[model samples]
Target: MCAYQEAGGTDMKTKNQSPRPALPRTPMTVERGVALIEALVALLIMAFGMVALAGIQSTMRRGSDQALQRGEALRLAQGEMETLRDYSVLSAEAAASGPAGTRAYAGVVSAAASSAGGNTDFSVTRSVADWADPVVGQEQQQAGLREVRVRVQWQDRAGNEQFVMLDSFIARADPALGASLGLPASTSATRRPAERSVSIPVAAKDLGNGTSVFVPSPTATVAWVFNNMTGVITGRCTVAMGTLNSSLTAADVAGCSNNTVGYLLSGVVKFSSAARPDPAQPGGTAWPLDVGIVNSTLNGAISAPVHQCFDDAPTSAANTMAFVSFNCFVEPNNGTPRIWSGRLELSGLNLGGGADAKKVCRYSADYDGNGSVSNSEHPENYNAVSGSLSRQNFLVINATASCPAGAAINPENGVFVNNSTVQQQPR
Candidate 1:
């Protein structure tokens, strides 16, 4: 019985040890699990690396695009700068021509922008900023140079922006040569002591609108007075008509016509120096004098044409009066402002005349052939004709005043020109 028990126990022990031996050899499932875990870890690492690489590529692309856009923008700005530099009078002309919209530059270019890089693009635009008042230039400043600024702005696809700017100075090229002629540079200024008013007479009736006539003045000689200190030039005392007639003979008229008459006359008077008026004579005087006649052909025929003038009416407002027919220089200041300078010669034949009836009258530079016939005619002698004048032999009037420095003279310098057909007449 003892031996049987021992055998049973051994058998039980053997049975228990039989499976234990194989189990310890390898953990197959655990190994598989660990392998799976490693595989998963490697996949995760690879995925992360790929994601990082993609991000780097995206950043690189954005950077490159941005660089390209910036380079293009710089190029565009340079091109625009070059374009603005070519215009000499950019400001004065900008109102007529200006830039407003996107324009292609150097071709093959596109630009845009957005929250994301490289979403927006670049385009060009322009505008002007004025730096001065136009009217004040004439009224107060006398000489006004307007400044115009041009700005160009651009944008890129990456939502980046850039801009360029340019400026120009513009003024009247042929402004009044008054300062050179002893005239004040502007109307607001004072007249110098040496300045004297000249009396230029004319017969408004005899000479038709387009007729170029030479009429002699009572004063044969006159002096152009200039003020070096003040830059003012004025017309001085004129010689009497009786003295002027002493040099000519009736036979001189025969060459022009059967009833030979003086129609127009114009000559220049020069002085050695600008001098003050003769205190004794109560008239203006200047230094050495040089007188010479000028013969100039008219650009257009002198004929009666529509003339318009504005005068203060009963309403106390400036309004246009009756239209007169006369020759005129057309200059538009914003609109039509009819202003002219010349002589009005009358004919003895046009106006019935007798002895002691002087037909000729002198005229100053201030003459506007506008408004009523009287407004454009010589106000002092509205009914008198200078003489029975021959249209063939007209005197060319040297009406222009020269600058002491050899510059041209005009009212723009500050002196008030009569610019009227009439003058200080017996009102």
Candidate 2:
């Protein structure tokens, strides 16, 4: 009984031990939580990579669309150029007209729409102009060259504007063909014999530094002649000035006095007739005249003499009014002169009512003979020169004229003249 009782006490003690406190539940480890967090971060990174790849693909597609649009614009421009070439070759009149100006064509369809086998939206523009071949020896217009330009414009996939252009040249078939179109038979055929003469008095103000302004008096006269039978015209002019009163005071002139020196002033004189034809004139023709410098002298001494002449020749048969450029110059003894040299350009001298004219001239001087015109060589430093004249000066000449039949000059017959004077300043 004692042994059985002891066994029962041992079992009760084991049971009362509370099953060893369940091993404290092992307390959940931090390492397992860390592994789960790392998996979630990897999934987030993969999602970002997929999004970036999708964006790259979209950009590539846009680039391809842009390229396709540009190619289509170029093709359209080329096609228009070919069409113009064919039309120009088919008609001599069309080629001679040279587009008359800029012509615009309507837009077709969008590039994206056209790519999908639909219509295309592209605009085209064309322009034609007369192209003169640059002659080597002379400054004269060469007939029969034409320039053609074509432009193509369109929009890209991104709605950005795009454009392409093409250029081409066309020439006359033959010299005889040009002649039939009212052009000169040859370069020599346009030359005519000089047949008239004139003399005019001129007054000039020496601005100093190789520059001067010519002021024509009412006494100035132009003697000209026109031969209707041969369509030949000619004229000669002379401007003489004995002495010019200085614009500055005597004390000022003496303080800035200089030695008498020679100079040459050169430029072009152009003449254009009115668009309306003369009533008495046999043919309803608009004539233009260009006379070059024949001879210019200073104190009875000839400087550089240039002999060139140009006459009115119509670009188109129905077109009236002609354009010509004549080189000219003058020399004067202004009593007190210094070394001077420069260039002159004159335009917009019309025989009729027309106002589009321009002139540009520049002059510089080496007063000390230092081989270059510097700031110290300016004429403003001299008291004799009232107006400020520096190393360069530009002047614009505006002159127009009207003449009737039997008048001393008639621009319709390609008749005109230039009278100029040169002077020296004390500075």
Candidate 3:
């Protein structure tokens, strides 16, 4: 049979073919497919790891940049605070005073580059406000106390808003030491002149008898100016008496009877010294003019003492005038009585001269003699004046009467002095 097979014989089923050499073993095709799958999976895992690492790196870089920006912001904020503090100190020293109520150094400063690339811009703003010491008495409210605030703003790299703020309290320097050291020569040389002025309405209350009381009008205005170089202070004030309740009619006023019926106030105020000094010396460092009053009907005037005058020297300009007191009495004998008393508070002291000079004054008056002041008795007033001097000049006045209540000026008329009104004018 083998010979037949080798010879290609036709014995169909009996011939044994050489077993076909086992079909070449097929080369383990399943194993080859599995190896390829494993290789693909390993590649996929490596790619995923690389991607995750990149994400982490990006996050770390962002975090680092944010930290840097935050640090820079803080630094800039501190720098701005220092700059403001320096300016305030220098200004206070130069002026020899603390800031008034609330004064802004200026508008927002120009934007500054905070980063080396100039991509980040920052702005600084500063404001100064009067700070009263709670521990101290009201008498020391304006002494050695101020609040300063500085704010810095900018945008971060991510286009997010960012800001930093610094707050501090500034105290007035010792007067003796400050004056001895003085300000820098350059600053002193650059000092500008100041103008002062005020306007106030006049009010009066009837105290009966032939006497009446006078005070600042319910609506009053005041202003002041200071000259750093000459150390002179110029001030002006205005009072309105149109609404005064007086017994004098248009005829009496026209006849000039108001002059004798009304009283005038005159007193000298010295800056850099105590109010109402024992001896009342002249030629002081700063001199305030005597407050004088005149009635439209009268040609003569009377003198009076100033009530509640404040001298803010230790913590402010050596010659600064803080507040003024004015009180007076008048007797027209027209069967009317009048009384008036009031005070003016001067704030926001500035160096330059302008309408702003009168912008920071507050006037208060007592109209009913209740010993309490009300908003109704206080009115906004304005004044305009121009002058340049180195000293502070202002007026403080008060008045009193010598007549008893219910006393009749004329017994025959049976129309004794009853309703009294005090009139005021600006000078």
List per-prediction Cα lDDT, in the order shown.
0.30, 0.35, 0.36
Candidate 1 vs candidate 3, lDDT winner: 3
Candidate 3: lDDT over CA atoms?
A: 0.36
For model 1 the local lDDT of residue 210 reads 19
Q: lDDT by residue for model 2 over 1-427, one digit each (tens)?
A: 3534454566744655755555555656745588778889998999999999999988998777767767777777777666544432223343455565322111111122122211347777777666544543221113234577777777766778877788887443322222244533444412322331111111223334222232222232321121222211222223333222233223323322232221222222222234422313313332232222322222343333232222223334355433222212222323333222222222222322346332221223432222333432322222211111211222222222222222222233443211111111101
- In terms of lDDT, the poorest run of 10 residues in model 2 is 418-427
Q: Per-residue CA lDDT of candidate 1, range 199-307, in tens? A: 1122211122211121233332422222222212211233334333334333322233222111122222111111321111212112121122211123442323222
Off by over 4 Å in 1: 1-26, 89-121, 132-427
My TM-score estimates for the predictions, one after another, are: 0.28, 0.30, 0.32
Report, for all candidates in order, the number of backbone clashes: 50, 8, 53
Tens-digit per-residue lDDT, 335-378, candidate 3: 22222222223323331344322111112233322344332333
- Give the better candidate number (1 or 2) by lDDT: 2
Ranking by lDDT: 3, 2, 1
TM-score of 2: 0.30
Top TM-score model:
3
